[model samples]
Target: GAGVSQSPRYKVAKRGQDVALRCDPISGHVSLFWYQQALGQGPEFLTYFQNEAQLDKSGLPSDRFFAERPEGSVSTLKIQRTQQEDSAVYLCASSTDRGSVADTQYFGPGTRLTVL
Candidate 1:
């Protein structure tokens, strides 16, 4: 019963560079989500995937951001041309079901990205 976990708990990137962060969701979970959290703000959904299908990605801020959950398990979030404005905590969450508000998502500690 491994919970979701993210890599690099912290990252520092120069503007214009690209970075890839990883996430490992709990085994057998069917839903996964990515979110961005800014200082003093609540986590905002970036995208969500049900199994290998990306069910929603309307919250991704720009084309520079991409995500995937190919195996219906682990997922990755990649940001290109990093901007100082992108500095924030990237969080990952997972649940047992999809398309239900009743699903309780468990979140990882998050990767704190700081763009310089």
Candidate 2:
């Protein structure tokens, strides 16, 4: 029953502040993703990582957004110079890659960030 979990379920940040969100994925999952969900829109992919390598990051909004999985288990999303538009729910999802055509992703509760 491995599950993904995020920290600081809620966060408040100043307009120009920097914030770091953490995500702990299911143990042994090789694929990880970071998503951002706005007020009314569905979750948008932000980044993806396979093991410790960042395979795709084209979905990231700006250079201010960054995500990393150093040891391939725990990932961190860092936002610098946060803006009001940056306020959203950050979600973490992970899936296993065991020679399967399709892997089901398990998502975390998400960390809601508010930039005032």
Candidate 3:
């Protein structure tokens, strides 16, 4: 399916390590989003981009977390100085449109990160 796809579906990192996750959104999609989910918790928004511009990053846990959509089609999320608290599933989503209350966000399978 030409929806959203993420790479490195699973990751294991020791504390203080760095990890990168990838996302490939549907072609022509304009809105991209990243979210984090802790065990037994719902996903929480991390950041969002409109095309190649980052519009919001208020949800990032700290400065150590970063995300970018260089060409607006593929995006990456990086976590530096990994901590046990950072262990969670990173989810990427894309919407064909943005700013409409009815717009639907399509989500990728997600990349689970486990930090020890």
Candidate 4:
């Protein structure tokens, strides 16, 4: 079965640098979510998208961070003016909206970002 996957599994950046992380979800999944996990901390929800519409984004830490789902299947998270504290694992999870499908989310291998 196909699953979610991320790109550039690792990243290094200087403070104030900008970076983009990509997530490719399983085809036909109707709901998508983004989460951030800091070192030694549980993942924190960042945003949620249903189809191509952004249903929730209250968890975004700052205006400098942004996410998009222009095609409903692939999404990107962008962080600008990055600080060392911004280092974390960015995770993408997706679930289907069909009946009989358990509301279980399949998570992607996260993209690790480090700001120096």
Candidate 1 lDDT (Cα, whole model)? 0.95
Poorest stretch of ten by lDDT in candidate 1:
94-103
Local distance difference test values of all predictions, in order: 0.95, 0.95, 0.94, 0.93
Per residue, candidate 3 scores C-alpha lDDT tens digits across 1-116 of 57799999999999999999999998999999999988899999999999999999999999999999998889999999999999999999999875576678999999999999
lDDT of 4 by residue, 66-98 (tens): 999998889999999999989999999999977
Q: Lowest summed lDDT over 10 consecutive residues: which window, candidate 4?
A: 95-104
TM-score of each: 0.96, 0.96, 0.95, 0.94
Per-residue lDDT, model 2, residue 101, is: 64
Which sequence of candidate numbers ranks them by lDDT, best first?
1, 2, 3, 4
Model 3 / residue 33 / CA error / Å: 0.4
* Residue 95, model 1, lDDT: 92
Native-referenced Cα lDDT, model 2? 0.95
Query: How far in Å is the alpha carbon of 52 misplaced in model 3?
Result: 0.5
- Model 2 lDDT at residue 73: 89
Better of 1 and 4 by TM-score: 1
Model 4 residue-pair collision total: 0
Candidate 1: tens digits of C-alpha lDDT, residues 10-75: 999999999999999998889999999999999999999999999899999999999999889899
Per residue, candidate 2 scores C-alpha lDDT tens digits across 24-48 of 9999999999999998999999999
Candidate 4 whole-model C-alpha lDDT, 0 to 1: 0.93
What ranges in model 3 sit over 4 Å off? none
lDDT: the better of candidates 2 and 3: 2
